[model samples]
Target: MRVHKFTFAALAVAAGLTLTACQSGEDGAAQGGASSAPPGSPAASAPASPGGGSSSGGTDQSGGKNSAGTGSDGKGTAAGAGSDGTGKAGKCRTGDLEITAIDSTVGGDSDGTVAVQLKNRGGQDCTLSEYAGVDLKTSAGSLSAKRTGEHPGPVVLKKGKAVSFGVTYPLNTSGGSGVRVTGLVVTPPDETKSVTLAWPGAATLPVTEGTGSPVKVGPIGSAGQGG
Candidate 1:
C-alpha cells in the first residue's frame, strides 16, 4: 500500500511540468509573430499620420501656385484691355477750326458763288457733314441763303486737312436796285458758333427784295476744290 501511494504522487508531478512547458512555448510564439510584422501591415502603419499631412501640404502648394499664376494672367489681361483705347475720340470743337471763303462765278442767271473752306487746325481729327449755314451781311441789309435739298456726305478731316462748300445767288441783270454785301457769316455743321469771313471785293452779291431770296447753298466737299 505505501509503494502505490508514492507512484501516484510522482505521476502528478510530471503532468504539472508538461502543462507549464506547453503554455510557455505558445506565449513565446505569439510575441514573435507580433514583433516580426511588416511595416506595410495595418497594425504597423498606424504611426504614418505625418505622411497624410505631407500629401495635403503638397496639394495645397500646387493649388496656391496655380491660383497665383491665374491671378497674374488676369491682371495682365485687364491692363491690356485698358490700354487698347476701346472708345473713340471725341468730336472737334469750333475753336479748333479755320474758315475761309473763295469767290467763284456760276453759269445761267446766277450771278456768282462763294466756295467756303473749312480747315481743321486742331491737333486731332474731326467730322463735318451737311450744308453750311451762310448769311450775307452788308451795310444795306442782311440776306440768308436757302439750303439745297441735296445732302453732302460726311467728311473726316485729319489735322491740317480742309473741306469746302458752295453758295450761289442770282445776278441783278435788270440793273434794278440791289443790296451790296460786305461780309459773310458762316456756321459749320453741328456747331452753334458762327465765323464771319470778309467778302472778296472783286465779286458782287446782288440781292432782290420781295422776289424770294435767290441765294442757294451746296453740300460740304473736299477742300481746295468744290464738289
Candidate 2:
C-alpha cells in the first residue's frame, strides 16, 4: 500500500511538469508568431480608439476641399456678377450736358486746332451726335469752323468733368476779333432727336490779330482777355 501511494504521488508531479512544459511551448510559439507578423498584419489592423481624432481629421479634409471649392465658385460668381452689373449700370449712368467753353482762335499764319471744351454742369454725361453749324463771328466776314460732323460723339463723361474736342480753322490774319461759337443738340444714328439752338451761342473768344495768337473774351474791365 505505501509503495502504490508513493508511485501515485510521483506520477502526479510528472504530469504537472509536463503540463507546465506544454504551456511554456505554446506561449513561446504564440510570441514568436506575433513577432514574425508583417508590418501590415491583421494584428496591425487596429480599431479606431475612443476619443481618437481621425474622424474629425477626415471630416476636416473633406470639408476643407468642399469649402474651398464653394468659396472659389462663390468668388468667381460674385466677380462675374459685379462686372456685369457695372457694365449695365455704366450705360445708364450718364446725363445731359452743355457747352462750357468754345475757343475758336487760331495759332499762327496757318490754321491751327480749335479747342472746344464742354463741361457737365449737370449731374450726367452728354453725347453730341452731330456738330451744329455756326459762323464764328469775327470783325471780318465770319470765319467758318465748318461742322463736318459731330465732335467727340458718344463721349461718356463723368459728373463735373469736362471733355475737349478739336476743330481746325484757318487764321486769315492776326488780329483781335470777337467770335461766337454755336452748338445745337443732336441725337446720333437716329438723327430724329435734334434740338435746334436758335440763339444758343457758344462761349465767345477773341482772336489776337497780328501775332495770330489766341485771346480770350473775359469780364468787362478785367485785365487779361480769354484765350
- Predicted model with the maximum TM-score: 1
TM per candidate comes to 0.57, 0.31
Model 1 per-residue lDDT tens digits across residues 111-204? 5777888888887767777777888886667778888877656766677877788887766566655567789898888889999989853334
Error of 2 at 132 (Å): 8.2
The Cα error of candidate 2 at residue 216, in Å, is 21
lDDT for 23 in candidate 2 is 100
lDDT of 2 by residue, 1-227 (tens): 99999999999999999999999889989787554547886545544557763333344354354333445446522333223344421221222444433345443435434444444555443333333333344434444343443233344445566555544544434354445444423222223443333322324445445634242222111111222
- The lDDT, on a scale of 0 to 1, for candidate 1 is 0.70
Error of 2 at 198 (Å): 11
lDDT of 2: 0.42
- Name the TM-score of candidate 2: 0.31
Which run of 10 residues does model 1 get worst, by summed lDDT? 75-84
